[model samples]
Target: MAIEYIEGDLIASGEEVVVHGCNTRGGFDTGFAGVVKKRHPAALDAYMEYHRNGGLVLGSVIWAYDGRLIGNALTQPTYGRAGKHISYAAVEACMQSIDDAARNGVPGTPFSGGFTRVSMPLIGADRGGGDWNEIERIVETTLKSVKTVVYVLPGHRPSADALSSRPRR
Candidate 1:
């Protein structure tokens, strides 16, 4: 199934897993990461502590909450716009992990039987300098079972058939 796109505020979707692509280097201090940091300080603390404890690894993920559910996919070695920082493999791996958590329940989250809806900004795109088409394909391929929503900022228009899950045209 293809990914569904929605133009709205991803940060305010506290009920959905606010997943975003970040580097293994740590610190949610720039771009969309910074927005996440400001909205969910506990996630930032968890990420900071996790980084300090040497949890740096591509394809890894860290889930944390502070009145908000945040999923940090360590899908890049670092962050910069000079070249592509996003790893296609890592993004897929991270999404697979999130798919597991969304299907079988995240170990520490308050809910059980996993999450029903998963939401995120374009994973591995934006500041990571990755291709959106590729990332969208990865998301569609990896997050098949659960309801998924890809949020974009306002002024961007979604497909007329955003509600459909058929393959991308």
Candidate 2:
């Protein structure tokens, strides 16, 4: 299936992805399945914690630092809440999670044997304040080899299909 890009409210349909404006407040809405927070460990942790607790992890630190669900992709623990940098070790760990997930399928679901659909927001956009292209490169490279479908939720318009087409560099 091709990746579809739609614009509206993130929480409206519990879509696989929801892009945020510069100052979007992650609220409780089933329209969007997840919110892409700018890369801050605390902020990310809060989002994860909220969701894991069955509260709201759309936009916060608790979720960012709390570790990520091993769904279709493996996510690394957020690093550098104090210093504004993504740790190398953390990156490796995160990549490994993706690898692990790709190999064995997510812990709970039955293994489909191929193609795990994973939707992720571009990391390091907010807190790291880095270039989107560079970050996209990192994400692309990390996830390229896996049999995973990445939902590249960027800005006003991100292509789920285009992301799927990007060959591993």
Those runs of model 1 whose alpha carbons end farther than 4 Å from true positions after fitting are 156-169
- lDDT: worst 10-residue window of model 1: 157-166
Error of 1 at 98 (Å): 0.4
How many steric clashes does model 1 contain?
0
* Candidate with maximal lDDT: 1
Instruction: Give the alpha carbon lDDT tens digit for every residue of 4-34 in model 1.
Output: 6776788875445778888887657887889
Q: On residues 73-163, what C-alpha lDDT tens digit does candidate 2 reach at each position?
A: 1122232224333333333445555544555654333432423444444444433344445545554566554533334434433454554
lDDT by candidate, in order shown: 0.78, 0.36
Candidate closest to the true structure, highest TM-score: 1
TM-scores of the candidates in the order shown: 0.88, 0.41
